[model samples]
Target chain A: NAGVIQTPRHKVTGKGQEATLWCEPISGHSAVFWYRQTIVQGLEFLTYFRNQAPIDDSGMPKERFSAQMPNQSHSTLKIQSTQPQDSAVYLCASSLDSGTEVFFGKGTRLTVV
Target chain B: AQSVTQPDARVTVSEGASLQLRCKYSYSATPYLFWYVQYPRQGLQLLLKYYSGDPVVQGVNSFEAEFSKSNSSFHLQKASVHWSDSAVYFCALLNTGNYKYVFGAGTRLKVIA
Candidate 1:
């Protein structure tokens, strides 16, 4: 299996610039998740999608962060006006169902300067 | 508020030595716990998981994790380590029936040959 695929393994952007991260989950997986990995904050859940529906996005920053899964195959996390504090590895994961063993993709390392 | 903590930020062991990575979770109800490994420049891969029935679950690469409800701990152990085993190990959790998973800061294991 190809597993999960994420585009632009590494990204660099200036402060105030908009950034978009993309994730293509494994085939047949119904659940997709987004997480931010950082040294201080650790790994934090940003949002999740199940069966192409937004289940819980409480982890997302209400103002700047947004995620969408128009189709089951792919999901996108968009951050408007990226900040230096937003620099982190944007990880995407997938599972057959909720609360199951999720597989992760090679995260998009976002570096905001 | 459910969460997972991996106290050790890093661990080092010689090849062929026994290894153990500790994980503790705080959850109101019994939740699903998992261990995942991420190699350098790679995505996270499932090592094993525990839902309910058994206290111990075996995962790929001869990795095993024991769930202790009384202590609220799920520690991952292996009888012997290999040079290839060097990677960052993460402990994750999910609510009783929720698919939203939360992950630990991660424990980086360095196996020396």
Candidate 2:
């Protein structure tokens, strides 16, 4: 399996611009997770979806960040009005089930300039 | 709320030396503990996991972790280290109730020859 696939290994967006990151989960996996990683904040959970449905997004910034799992195969995270503080590695992960081992994709590094 | 803590922010060890990376967690119910490693410019890879039964669990690359319910800790260990083992190690706890992973502030390991 290709594991989880995240598009755009790197992205650079001007401040106030919007950025959308894509993630294609492994086949047959029922759970998908998004996390942000930076030197200051090790790893922070952003949101998650189960079977194409958003389960919890408590960690999300809420104001300018949003996530959607349109189908079983893919999900997307969109950040509006990006700022330098938004720069970080966005990681996507999937698991066979909620309680199973999670496999991660080579994250997309978002650099807001 | 479930949480994880990795006390050491960075650790350095010589090749062939033994190593231990500490982790402590807080959760009310039985947790699914995991250790993941992140190489430079790469994604997080699962090293090991523990749910129940044996307290000591084995993982990839000669790595192992011992879980202690009494102490609320799951510490990763290696008998001998190689330079390739240098990476950031993260301790995570999976909350089965919500199926979300709470991660620790990772510990960076630098193996020197």
Candidate 3:
């Protein structure tokens, strides 16, 4: 199994630039999640999708952060005007269903200068 | 508000030594617990999980965890660790109905060969 595939293992962007991270979940998975990992916050939940629909996104920043699951196979997290505070490991994970264990992607390390 | 706490930011041990990592969660009602490990430049992998029965649950790589509902704690332990066991370990909890997994900050382990 390929597990979960994330594109662009590392991403670098300048201030005010937009950054988009992509995640391809395991086949047959019905749930996808987005999380941000930092030294301070540790690991924080950003958003989650179930059956390709946005389930909960309370953890997402009110502005400049959005996520979408246009198709069942792939999901994307976009951060507009990426700032230094936004620099962290953006991790994407998927689970077989809403009530099953989740598998995580290698994650995209974003560095905002 | 739901939250998880991993008191130890880092734990060091020698190879072939027993290991124990502490974890505590704050949530109401029955909670599903989980332990995951992440190696360098890799995604987090499920080590083990606990729901009900069997306070002690075994996971892959000879890892195990004990759930203490009264104490609201779920700690991960390994009988013996190898150099390959050096990684970051995270503890998580899920709600009974919705599978909202909340993760702790994570404990980084360093094993000396």
Candidate 4:
């Protein structure tokens, strides 16, 4: 299995620009999750989807961050008007279902310059 | 309201020595506990998880964790350390009802020769 696949291993965006990260979940998995990793905040859960529907997004920044899972196979996280503070590694994970072990992808490193 | 905490920000141990990393959680009920390791420039990988049953759970690469309900802790341990084991370890708690994983600040482990 290729596990979860995230595109653009690294991305550099200027301040006020937009950045979009992509993720392809494992086959037959029902849950997809997004997280942001930073030295200061550590791993922060941004959002999650189960059965192609959003469940919780309390961890996401209300203004610039948004996530969508249009289908069972893939999901996207978009950051609009990105700022320097938005620079961090974005990780995507998938699990068979709730309470199951989740597998993570290599992650996309976003650098807002 | 729910959260996980890893007290030690960094830890160093001699090669072949025993190691232990601490983790604590804040939640009303027993949540699904997990230990994950993140190598540099990579995403978090599941090392082990504890749902119910036995308090001690084994993981890949000779890693193990013991869950303590009374203490609200799930600490990871290894009998011997190798240089390759140098990575950041995160403790997470999942509320099966919500399906979101709350992660700790993480502990950076370093094995010295």
lDDT of 2 at B55: 99
Per-candidate local distance difference test = 0.91, 0.96, 0.92, 0.94
Over the stretch B1-113, how does candidate 2's per-residue lDDT look in tens digits?
88999999999999999999999999998899999999999999999999999999999999999999999999999999999999999999999988889899999999999
TM-score of each: 0.95, 0.98, 0.96, 0.97
Q: Model 1, DockQ value? A: 0.83
1 versus 4: better TM-score goes to:
4
Instruction: Write the residue-wise lDDT of candidate 3 on B1-113 in tens digits.
Output: 67789999999999999999999999888788899999988889999998789899999999999999899899899989999999999999886566778998899999998
Cα lDDT of model 1 by residue, B15-52, tens digit = 99999999999999988898989998888888998988
Comparing 3 and 4 on DockQ, the stronger one: 4
Number of the top-ranking candidate, with lDDT as the measure: 2
| Local accuracy of candidate 3 as per-residue lDDT tens digits, A1-113 | 99999988999999999999999999999999999988898888899999999989989998999999999999999999999999999999999988778899999999999
lDDT of 4 at A56: 90
Task: Give one digit per residue, the lDDT tens place, for model 2 in A1-113.
Answer: 98899999999999999999999999999999999999998899999999999999999997999999999999999999999999999999999999998999999999988
Better of 2 and 3 by DockQ: 2
| Candidate 3 accuracy as TM-score | 0.96
Candidate 4 Cα misplacement greater than 4 A, ranges:
none
